[model samples]
Target: MSSAAPQAPDAAPDQDVRRIDDRSPWWGRLRAAVGRSRADLAVVLLFLAAAGWLTHGLWPDPGSRTMALNPADQVLYEWFLAVDARALLGDFGLLTDRLNAPDGVNLMANTTVIALGVLLAPVTLTLGAPVTFALLAGANLAGTAVAWYLLFTRPLGARRLAAGLGAALCGFGPGMVSQTNSHLHMTAQWLVPVIVWLVVRMLRAADPGRGGPDRLRLLSSAVGLAAAVSAQVFVGEEVLFLTFVTLLVMAVTYAVVDRDLARRALPAFTGGMVVAAGLALLVVGWPLWFQFLGPQGVATGLFSPHYFSADLRSWWTLSPLSVVGGDDAARLTTGPAEYNTFLGWPLLLVTVGCALWLGRRPLVVACLVSALAMGALSLGPRLVVDGQHTGVPGPFALLADVPVVDGALPMRFALVVLPLAATLVVLAVDRASASTGRARRLVPAVVGAALLPLFPAPLPTSGRPPVPEFITGGYWRQCVPPGGVLVPVPPATPRDPWPMRWATATDVAFGMPEGFFIGPHGRNGAATIGTSKQPTSALLAEVATWGLRPAVGEEQRRQAERDADFWDASCVALTVDTPYADSLRGTLEDLYGPSTRIADAWIWRV
Candidate 1:
């Protein structure tokens, strides 16, 4: 019995035992080497090369009017330019003043564009607007690429081919392609899918069983969600829909899968949202808060079902494929093409198929519910009248009337549903592919083919007619020139939509003269104004009255005269449709004699 039967040779310690090198075999390595990353890189490079060629061929010739600025873009560009110029010169007060001015407040509401402007400030300051635009655009493209990579990596199991295809789909997708020249806000909007994917991953990681410093994971998730939310807020109400859909998906998923987890997730989610909300507030929150809280806020009238409805036919017939360009005056009916662009229909079909097929998986179910909820909103009144509203019935009617939701362009809610739909389609195809060999090979191909038409089409170089430049007139021309001053103008009529409504008045009066602008309304600009209660006598006097006529009367003219004298405004620019334009023009001419027309609305010192 010699002691303990000579204990068997101590098993090799886990640390000492070498684990099987799970490294891919040489053939597998070779296949991977030639696959995914390499292929994706090649595709990306090809697209870039094509873009480069197009840029070169279509590059705006020096002095070419074709490159003349888009009015909306010009307003933003100049505003940022002014701020960056002031910030660089150490005139923080001046910069702040110009930013907070009524006009500045309006533009600031466009958080997406404003954020881009903020990011681009340094570049614009250093490299100038052209280069800044180029840099941001390139970055947006890169972002799309990265987002695609992330999307394909985890849920799709690092399937390089599929990832590459997805990335290509995003790059060439109708949404991305159409928005190429629009700048950061729309570009960021196009990245919503990636944002959704990242949020999903973080949520998955946050699963308690998958524990590793969950607080850290929660923080990371919040940051991503917040960033996505912030980006949406900046872009417009359209993106808000996307953010809502994403949050709803996460919320519902957690609720159905594990109510306890959902409960736990809420605080973390809220915390993340707060972070984003706080950031938004810091950037442009003050004015938004004021709008909701102040006198104008109540008068603005939020939440109307009619507000959400749009002529759906425009979605299909107005895109590049349709002969109709954006005829703002034209009215059209709802059609399949309007809402679902090139890839839209195919994606929808696939999504429906996937929902039906993978109805069992919790993730799939969660995605389905989220998509249907958003889709119902997108359908607007149709869902209710058709009796389909029973599925998601809520006081959507009540919710629709909620101030925040109602105050915005309600039709834009479709954007919120998009990512969920995309995820569902991807998941369905993913599941189908995983089930069998034929499906695996065929699924991605079908997805790819379906998305192909959405890619940018080659345009004929010779006949590419020159786009006409719009003559800048009115308020835009006046305030943008050197030595301009805010000319008090009347509050916009409700019928005037967007920049035309509020931004036009503010940009001319405040932004033009001050050398900074925000948007079409004082909403965003007022936020930038922060808590500084200092009144803009000129602005207050004019906007105190709602209609445009009185704002342009003798009182405004006398004030404009005084401002011209004080601010050394050599010219006056007035936005058309304002009663004050004619009065201001006559007063200026009578007082200062003659002025020259720079563009349409701009009047300059003779």
Candidate 2:
């Protein structure tokens, strides 16, 4: 009977098939929860608010009564105003024009980070210049947050307290705070770490086992590398150094981990190089090629050292703590390093120890190698003899010889080192935390303790002099009253022994009649002098130069004259503790008749 019923062909044995899906809704929820916790949303929010308040409070209102109080802020204000003008005219072409403009290229020529302000063009249109500057400041803050997350989360392995401290260290780092007013480009330097993290992610994805490294991933890495390099070029050398160090670290790490992985990394590495080359061609290569390629190229002397020596001591002590307590205390005592310095020196020591302990870990080993490489680069031999023999300069000399970077004085590449330092500090803290229990608690406690002395105190407002009114008026006055032009006059300085300053003033004055001066003493003023032989005419030479359609305005000539007078009078009139101001006073009297003072600024008629 059992055979007849046929047992339904043995009825398969009721195999209770249970399907399990690896992906679950709770998985996403879990990830989100973890990310939120690691980030410390509340603390981040608080820091953001504080940053916003400080930015808003310190920023001068466009056309308001407040004047630019510091050299750094002054430069940013002028640069913003210039950008605002170009934006108002809807002249995207000015991208080129501004780049070539005497002041535009002069201030930003060597340092490309000034271009980051271009992102503010839309913001400027929507909210006005004040808001744009505010946004710019906010972007710096956002960059810090991104940098913190990037440094602490993955490579440092996300510990909330360590991450928070690392972020705070970056936000309040000495170089960051010291140049807060002047180093807008350095502020943009924060982007480098983010880019590094992206590259690392792409590299990790391409780790051979994961589908053997996709071409797309390689392409993306290349694109990202190009973008990072381009951004550094825009920001100038400091950021450039950071980018270089970061890439070098990654490259070395890849090399050490697995020779095969290093080989595989070639495509991505080359792709990045190609991208960077393309961008360089677009920005400086084409123009330089055209300008210097022919017979005239030799005359330009692109290889010449057009600037003076920068102080080495200043670069090393850019931090407030270093300035105050380090050996070079006397030289750095004057700046505002009071509030924004890192307090975790002992923690930093512990971090170093932990890093040494974790030296075998791939990421840590890579970072350590990177740090050593960067240090060697920054502090390596000059190789003057080698440079002369080779005709081609070494990388360090070439970097120092670059225009904007050359003018950075002692801190020529400090922008580059700051991130490395920050990363080391973060990594160190992370390592300590990961070690045995005692070390973890000790690291944070030591850091907190060191930071105690530098805790921010209420900055005094009473002694804070009112920012000049003209600086306010020129920056704010939306429309350059039809006939008026903004003319920038170079401020008189002991370093500027020649009448070259006058030429710069004349060049800026030649453009528009609104009579708004932006020069050495005005907005966008800096320590270096413009050296372009045809500074005044450069903007008119090429449509691509100012990113504007080529057109001439009749009013431009008359405006130039008015601007010249303003430059001759105001900038020259503002005397200093230097002899150059006295020479400028005499030069102004010869060029334009004696003029009465307008607020703190003097007005002269040619």
Candidate 3:
């Protein structure tokens, strides 16, 4: 059992009550939010330092730089720019024709990072999206860690040192670093703690034996929880979904293990959850409707569950994200930055060992069971052992066909298990390190040896070329009217949203033909992205792809005019020396006469 005294559910820990942040009024909470404490400031500094080191390529300047080979990062940059444009324009619609042109896309279905977009609007406006991206990338990991640290210390009854250990594991662990590859939604998990904290408080207040829930107080707490969940929907619906699954698993397991306590908790738990869900639905109903039923919405089952499921050996391996590992160690499980659960043998053993050792403790049991359940679900229907698919089905079979849940990647279920492992490991480390016996002296050495192999490397980044003078120096602005379409020669594809670099840097004053984003593919609303090819554009794309020019005849000429009109193209700009640039220029010249010289390119007004 945990070496802590149990208290009434409604009672605050004496230590927590002593803290001014908890006891003081709104001003004190505001101070805490602003991170007034020395420890909090230290965490911020640490995070800033980490961000600087990780995104060094984007340092000292961003408008003139980019991160190469990170399509996800690139997509997020567009989102920042898009959100900024929409907010400033007073547009409430999440759908846009800026990319995927005529088809447009429902931004709600994409990783729009709405919460981050709104929260960091000031920074984005002043500094640009790349800097915002870089800062948020680092802050997400650090902030999540700090949030977990606070929760562990205050509510979970862990020591400050123990909380730090857990926070470090939760913040910069392999799972988090892997997500930093490009997934902002998964990375920006700071609100998860806030939601969890609120839920715990509500649950405590709901305990009937502790004078029961005061109707007004319980309703208010329910509202708070609802707001948190609603906020999460805009932030990361997948993470929100995963949170629900994690809590449900924990609750179910707890009920199974402790029947009497389960009975006592059942009514309050259900009521609180019901109220929270209802209120959350009210807040997100319209967006949810647009996401599912509006134009460009996609169907479930974006990818095969089994294909994306975890390899059994992945849990015991290391990834390139690990500081101590080489390419060989990294290759043992999947490619770089995709290792969802490369827990490594040492950490896995330590986590399981701790869970077994602490099985008697209710809190420990809950954490362990939740982690194990998520791990099982991550493995998908078919077991893959050492990259070989075994014919056996797995635990995820139960959820494989379930609506929005089915849209989630089975492998990403490991995210829910991540914090549980961190919590368990920290608890074990705290008990061992804080002991008075001789074991205390050896604890550091043993723990270091086990954890050293899993230490995360600084995030890997690459340099990209800066925005072209055409856009930055305002040449494109001269050619295209505000909000007019400036179709690039080789527009943009779903896979290569390269033009977005210019689009975003130009502050999204104009739209492009097609850019990187997901939208409806066919009559059935299949999820697809990238450019849809028509005749003239198709010919141009083929030329870009193969360096071969097709015959541009009368039909193609008419098609080109139609395409330009369709895109509402104010000017057709061709960047010199881009793939098949010569052919594209010749074709456009045939259709619309010689192009006028522009900065770094030629433009023909539509």
Candidate 4:
């Protein structure tokens, strides 16, 4: 029949086949990669949904959603938005006059999260600060989970569902959930796995047993690692520091357990680290200098490590972020920033058991020591469970004097456990699914049960009163001249924080005398902010705190004038909703004569 052979029309006489190769233009390959990323878009969407669901109360009205446990976190977010506004105006001062007024704060010294602030600038500029905070918070959880998921599935060769389990456990587990209540800086852990992935790529390329990578591949990996570390510095330097400590410990553990593999991987890993550190220093050298050696910065931790060390009982306690957590969950925490450090009995047992059972495996051995070491440190300088403090000090006390490491909280070291736990759990789940006979049924059931109580509940939120109309509606702009200060009458305190609110609402158009920021406090260069208790400020703070109008004498009047002159404040305004607003206004009137009413506040032009 005619169909004995089907032959395609031969290439045209002059035509030649062109093979697909690296010859494709850079942008063309970039576009192709972008298209492939759409496959991961699902992971992003799923994570975003999960994060949003957990903190859903923040949505619908992002402006009003507040962090009840950590008011300082909200204050920091407002500062981030203010920074974004300044950046939009073409003013990129790393040291801001908006906070400490005449004196300023080195942004590098704080957890400013410069990269996140810049990246989310548009969202903050448009919807306002609180909304930007909520979005970032959600993104932090989701993005972190997705990053781990990609690493497990793409390079580590884990199954899809298994990878997802790993991702969820890392992203939304109790530790992460607790941090979500506040602490945007610590929550930004998405980059850790990315660094690991890049390091792995370099290690594979450098493996002598196989054909090692070319110079170009090694260089590329090195550069990539450098970029990731630099970005991580902006997100959370403490986390980055912890990452470094954890990696070193894990590497040592691996060397002890599997010397040959360590021998193969260590040189390449060390070379890559050198490259990354050198590049990071080059990019951020000046800022780092200011942070460590300049006027505002402190070389060591601002507080003693003992103050931030975790209580041992915190390991078994439930976090407020958990569905089963009670109202007292907040009481158990060291502060607003460390709530989710809880490691439930079941989850802890499974993770430790898996680490023990899978000891011979390279992945398990490396992760096991990382978790154990960090966990021990989280127990703090001395072991404290429930309420009693034990005389036995923990491992972290050794690092308390180690330069920058001293400044970081020991409790946060617990973050190392979640990812390791996730990896172990995923391996178990995947192995069970792939196994034969009775093994398959039992393992999955066990894995599911271990994670049951760890499931998160929606994050609790409170209402944040909106900024007054005087600043938001732009009336304050008319009052304060260029470079002049706008000092709120009650000044700034942790509770009310009016000056900070007004300054943020006005987009830092005017300087502020005091704000809710960390800055030089006493002779020690100790970190503190908000209104200092000067004679005049103390009088105002007293009335505000006690809701009582104290007698204002000529001394108080003279003191007010002196403060305004020193601050160079062009105008002094008072918000109606400020704590004991009326009383403070009455006291101000007694001191500064009759004040002009403007919008929802009283203003006095200096």
Top lDDT prediction, candidate number: 4
The estimated TM-scores of all candidates read: 0.63, 0.62, 0.91, 0.90
The digit string of per-residue lDDT tens for model 2 on 447-539 reads 666544433322111122333444434521332232233332332122221112222112122232111122232223332233232322233
- Which tens-of-lDDT digit does each residue in 71-161 have in candidate 3? 5455555555446446755656778766666667687877788777777776777777777777777778878888887777667766555
Worst 10 residues of 4 by lDDT: 1-10
CA lDDT, every model vs. true structure: 0.43, 0.43, 0.72, 0.73
- Residues 163-247, candidate 4: write the lDDT tens digits: 7778998999888987887688888999999887877676666555445534566778889988898889878888888888887
Model 3 lDDT on a 0 to 1 scale: 0.72
Clashing residue pairs in candidate 3, if any? 381-394, 494-530
Question: TM-score: which candidate is best?
Answer: 3
Runs in model 3 with CA error above 4 Å?
1-36, 64-69, 72-76, 214-216, 329-335, 439-445
**Any runs in candidate 2 off by more than 4 Å, and if so which?**
1-40, 50-77, 93-114, 122-131, 154-157, 235-237, 257-260, 267-318, 321-348, 376-417, 428-436, 450-528, 531-606
Clashes of 3: 2
- RMSD, every candidate, angstroms: 10.8, 13.4, 4.0, 8.4
Residue-level lDDT for 581 in candidate 1: 61
Q: Give the residue spans of candidate 4 off by over 4 A.
A: 1-41, 327-330, 529-531
lDDT (tens digit, per residue) of candidate 1 on 404-472 = 554544344544444455555555454544455677667666666655544544321221221111122
